[model samples]
Target: MYVAVKGGETAIARSWDLLAAARRGDESVPELTLAQIRQQMRLAVARVMQEGSLYDEELAALALKQAAGDSMEAIFLLRAFRTTLPRFASSLPLDTAAMRVRRRVSGTFKDVPGGQILGPTADYTQRLLDFSLAEPSVPAQPARAAAPLPDALPCVLEVLDREGLIEADLPPAGDPDPVDLTREPLMFPAGRPARLQNLARGDEGWLLGLAYSTQRGYAESHPFAGEIRMGEVSVFVCPEELGFEIDIGEITLTECQMINQFGGSKRAPPQFTRGYGLSFGEAERKAMAMALVDRSLRAEELGEAAHAPAQQAEFALCHSDNVEASGFVQHLKLPHYVDFQAELSLIRALRAQNPQEPTHD
Candidate 1:
């Protein structure tokens, strides 16, 4: 017999007020506008959009502001808001070869077509904190040569494909409709499309840890960074009434192709297998981690032993969602008085019955 706890409404309202005050700390400092957050904190905005499965930068920025710069909270807010919007259309698959490449790099080849463009990366920068960023200063401009870029850049994997060194990237025969994880419950023994869909919006930190485990001999495979390209790609949607595809918009994307050496299987010869990852913006680390995890999940398909946690599709895909993980973990903070009280009563009754047996204490 547990009694219900009461008097939380007024306290909850007061807590909201306190939260608002804390979120807007130091009144003298100017408040951050959505535009400022959208532009300056573009990476954060991109991440929220990616994880939330919503492309609106404005909404993402608002979510970030409302959540006080907590990326996961911002993602949650954006995802909740996304549930209200009606789905009007589904876009055709993007063509990465035709992307207006801003940044491109490859680890396997020394001279890839389109020449390695190291656009706006912190990879070469010193890790030490730069105190100069605190003070405003005139930025220095560097001289540059104007050159027109190619319409389409050849993929590194395509080069391997020509020589019969890698497996052909072909859709399965009969080309079945892909499972939309949003509309359908994620069933076990998921195909590549469903697995990639889950991993696309999966928590970056969680995926990173799983990927790191693979490299540390959990599911060791010689992997090469075939190519990583970040740029803007056009999106197209074909409306039923229109009966033709139309260019809807363009969005920034980071695509990664990982090539892993695979031994000969019963059905095929020794060749290179591929892992792919695509993200909303210049999320190189996330994309790379996703690629590693993607490849790991394909262990069964490739006829390899699923000896590691990362290689286990069910474990990886089911736990990848941060929103689900956060909700389950945070729910513990909610009132559990009734449930605990029941357990308490049961324990007390058992102890009273066993009083003579515990007399040694």
Candidate 2:
């Protein structure tokens, strides 16, 4: 019973009807198909996959439709569905170096191992609204090269890595398994892997704000975009019985590697530290934001100061999940009649104790 309201079920059913009506808009207008959302509204689908911790484009698109395009609601729906799925064996480490390059760019150097490919980017385009797109028109298609690109293109960071200018990514001793954050609660004093996992599944707007803070000098930050690569990488999973890896399929990914200056200490030499971010699709902004935040959170491990909220692992990871945050914040909408009444009585008593002054009239 919602606050002892009568016929709550009827109200709820009516509410659902209203939601559906609104979602459909005009009945004459064609309803958006799942394929349309998956292909046309790709970024929305990507965000739902990233934050929901699920990688199914179809499901993400469905969730978006069910939620009527409310991203937070869509994420909640996707996660709810994901909870019912059975887990298979963990996949092998993704070989990003072997990714089929679609878009690759680096800010650190003029040229990288493979020449920068500005593939299907709107970054250089004017921000003016194109009224022409409002009408149905034939879309333009890009020309393909005579020859196919190499199967494997060297990572842009390799240029810096060769000279030992950037820090090496040495695996921790014993090579422990990374934390499955979805299964385990994020405890305080979380490790790099845990932080990375949280950030990967974190809310984009929240991460973006924190990442922007680092750039604005909220933390000791002079980060450079070493590379941003968007491509399709093969996913391999090894079955315990098979005893060998099998390529399941390919998924589009956007990877960002940020290089930041770090002063040398007694135990280490001066070199550029790395901040890494990976997204499920061509989510360049999200990937870049994740990398910046990843670096800031490494402040303690790198023997630097944690002067910002993003640097604090507990704060960062706890609030990263928009689902949880939204729940807590939105719960206020629920009936709180008793609590409100109690507060009302107390406030009345307090006001009675401190009577108002006599009016001049």
Candidate 3:
């Protein structure tokens, strides 16, 4: 009979104390403020919020600070904290058509309806390092056009839809609302909604790699970035007390619409299909990667070959979570002394049986 013991309590406590001390750094140096992290490390915060599946910028910044800039740890921290919060009524579905546009572009078309509005992006900037950034100076304010982009920019996909060139993007009439992913494990043969949600929360690097695999001919898909846009959208929720929905607040969002190769039957003429991706902030790369993976995953529905890894639902959704992946991988650092000792004893027995066996550890 074996009994478990509560070992390493004092050492664990001391280790954490040491960690706290290390996090603070030299006492002479001023500690970092949460506000500074929130403002300055906006991209980092956005990644945490997006991957963590939480929308609070402040909380995401706090998690980042606590994790010492490790994105995986920060996402885990935010997710752990988010589990404690109570859920109220769910918000009404967002109207992307009414989104307040900040940045908008299309690779498929040279000039979209509202003209390509390149608002607050570093896409065209030269890659050379700016040494001046080390010594901070107030940067000059960017010039603004007299009339900014229109309140709601038309979607490029919608333009294709008008000419009956793109497949219709609508849900089945009798389909139920999407099941909350947190409450239930993702079932195989997942609906589009759940698949999209999983991709949205999936690891960005993993998705990027898989997306690249598709472009490299791992899967058959010729993708065109129909449009990519980032901006604010209003959220509305209707509480039990209030019969009508009330405006909550605005949240920054990035959306990507990818156009893929024609998927038409003998009855229908050749037309384009779509892949969609959306994130909490200006995570364009993530959005684009997600779009590619999403299109790849739809191979089965389109009656195309599903031989690629990206097209497999189990392969994508099960391993996409960075927090879970890191936890399982890093847990090897913890004590495995007992198991190792058992293996060692078995090895010793085998060595005793064959004295001529060379000594090995």
Candidate 4:
């Protein structure tokens, strides 16, 4: 005799109230404003925007606040809200070459055209917590250089390409429409565009793990960070009525170019292969991880052995979404009384039939 639980509606309503109260916390502390989150917690806002596939900083800030500072929840909220918005026009492929770079670095070369600019990084900062930040105050700023950084810096990969050290970057014959993962199911043997799209919104920790696995002898990739540039890029959209591309806005972006050593194959000669990653804002870790995973997923194309989990496109793309992962993992809390009862009955009947031997205490 199975009895269904009632009062679900009332319970859910109360749960919402509880959640609201918890989110608000103590009234003594000042409530966090959306503007403060947008300005101060800019990195968090950037991550939500990037993963949520929405460029609105204000909306991302609101989502972060509503999510109680949980980035995954913020991303989910932003994504859900994005689905309700009407699509106007698709943007043209971004031009990274013309980016107004604020930070740029290369691991392969000693000196690049415009010397490496280590802008606003905590890499060299000590791990110790600063107690002074509890009562925050404006700090003196360093004087800026009179001249601005070069608008366009030469790509490190291009320098190698000139020396015939890397494979030539040739575009496909015709510009084809990219598969929209949001609307369509991600099929295996995915093209670069589809894989990149999936990786861009993929969970950071998961991607980081996969990337780390590759470095730990999972894959044989002699990879070098060719270039990593962080700055602003203009977004353009072509409306059907206008029949001309229009600059919609500018977005902060991080672009990584990874060069991997490739042995000569039957079809192609020995050359350095390329892996690319581009994301919204200054997400160097995510971008770098994406690049590593990108290269690993290209094993088939490069005629290399696909032995690692990261090398499998089906595994990588399918398990990347945090929203899906959270849902599946959390669903264990759901009632399974019927199934458990059946298992319990089966186990008891089997025990009665086959008298188990008593263990010596």
Best by lDDT: 2
For every model shown, what is its TM-score relative to the native structure? Answer: 0.93, 0.95, 0.93, 0.94
Residues 1-361, model 4: lDDT tens digits: 1223445898979988999999999979999999999988988998898889888899999999999999988998998889899987889988898998888899999888888888878888998998988897897697675578887887777888888889877777895888998788788779999999999989888888998998888988778999999999999999999999999889999999889999979978898998888888889998999999999999989888999999999998899988788767765667878999999999999999999898998
Off by over 4 Å in 4: 1-7, 139-143, 358-361
lDDT of 1 by residue, 94-155 (tens): 88888988888999999887788888788999899999989876967964536766666778
lDDT of 3 at 309: 97
Q: What stretches of model 2 exceed 4 Å from their correct place? A: 1-7, 358-361
How many clashes show up per model? Answer: 0, 0, 0, 0
**Model 4 lDDT vs. the true structure?**
0.88
Residue lDDT tens for model 3, 298-338: 88888889999999989988899898888888777667899
TM-score leader: 2
Q: How high is the lDDT of residue 324 in model 3?
A: 83
TM-score of 3: 0.93
